[model samples]
Target: MTYGYIGSMRTRSGRRDDVVAILLSAAGSLRELGCRSYVVGLAADDPDTIVVTEVWESKEHHDASLRSPGAKEAIAAAMPMLTGEFTSRETTVVGGLGV
Candidate 1:
């Protein structure tokens, strides 16, 4: 079974783009660590919100990715721009298009 994770974060005003860039900076590294899919989305109605949907080979892979140097750097760069509000869910991916 694959591991799926969806996370939504609220960025400080005018900081969404910067935070999004920071997150994307590590996308390549994540792929090398077993990420199957990684998508970043912005809410059209809420400019400050960022939604990240990811599928990993397993829960262990997902967890390990977070500990990677690139991931750690991205988190450090984006944290200050965030509003401390977040929503996240973990799931077992069964089947899906492009997944």
Candidate 2:
């Protein structure tokens, strides 16, 4: 089954741009990680909050990608822009409910 990950982050005050830049760089690494889809968006009601969604071929593929050098570097680079602890959840894709 396909694997998906969603991460929620909040940028430090006055650091939204920095956070977005970091995420963009992180997206580049994610692209090399067997990622089928990757997207980052800002929360509509909260400018400081960002949401990242990723789809991978499988859980194993996502795990392997986590250990990649690019992933490591991207994560390290993003750390400083974070305001609060980031949260993540993983799930399996079942039948889609109409969006």
Candidate 3:
């Protein structure tokens, strides 16, 4: 079964865009690591929040991607900009359009 992950992070004051950029910088490389889809979104009413949605070939693929250098670098770069507040959920992707 495909693995799906939905998560959100709260960035420090004015750092949401920066964190988003860092996350996107690794988007191109994620596919090579088995990612099927990766989407980033901002809340209309929350300037400090960033939401990320991802689908992977499997749970193992998702796990491996986190250990990737690009992912690690992105995380390191964005950590300081975040408020340490987050929301996340892992799901089994049954079927979906574009996914």
Candidate 4:
């Protein structure tokens, strides 16, 4: 089954776009590692938060992505800009516009 992950990150003031940039830059690497979709966007009312929506082949694929080369690099690059602040929701994708 496809696994979906939505991660919300609140960066230290003025760093939301910075982290989004890092994620975008690392997108290709994650795509190569079985990430079906990696969508990055901002909350309409909150400029400090970045919302990331992802789809993976499975929950294991999603978990394994954390260890993927691109993910490792992205995490390292975004770590400093991040306040370690975030929220998330995981779900089993039964059906969707895109899997």
Among all candidates shown, the one with the greatest TM-score: 3
Candidates 1 and 4: which is better by TM-score? Answer: 1
Model 1 TM-score (2 dp): 0.96
Per-residue alpha-carbon lDDT of model 1 for 1-99, expressed as tens digits? Answer: 899999999999999999988888788778789999999999888989999999999999999988988888889889999999999999999998988
Candidate 4 C-alpha lDDT tens digits along 1-99: 888999998888988878988988878777667788999999999878899999988889888889877778888888898888889999888877866
Error of 3 at 50 (Å): 0.3
C-alpha root-mean-square deviation, each candidate: 0.8, 2.7, 0.7, 1.2
Give candidate 2 misplaced runs (Cα > 4 Å): 95-99
lDDT of 2 by residue, 1-99 (tens): 888889899888888878788778767656566787788888899888899887888899889987888777777887788877688999896645421
TM-score of each: 0.96, 0.83, 0.97, 0.91
Q: Residue 92 in candidate 4 has what lDDT?
A: 85
The Cα error of candidate 4 at residue 96, in Å, is 1.6
Order of candidate numbers by TM-score, starting with the best? 3, 1, 4, 2
Q: Report the poorest 10 consecutive residues by lDDT, candidate 3.
A: 65-74
Best of the two (2, 3) by TM-score: 3
Better of 3 and 4 by lDDT: 3
Pairs clashing within candidate 2: none
lDDT of 3 by residue, 1-99 (tens): 999999999999999889988988889988888899999999888999999999999999999888888778889989999999999999999998988
lDDT of each: 0.92, 0.80, 0.92, 0.86
Error of 1 at 38 (Å): 0.3
Cα lDDT over the full model 4: 0.86
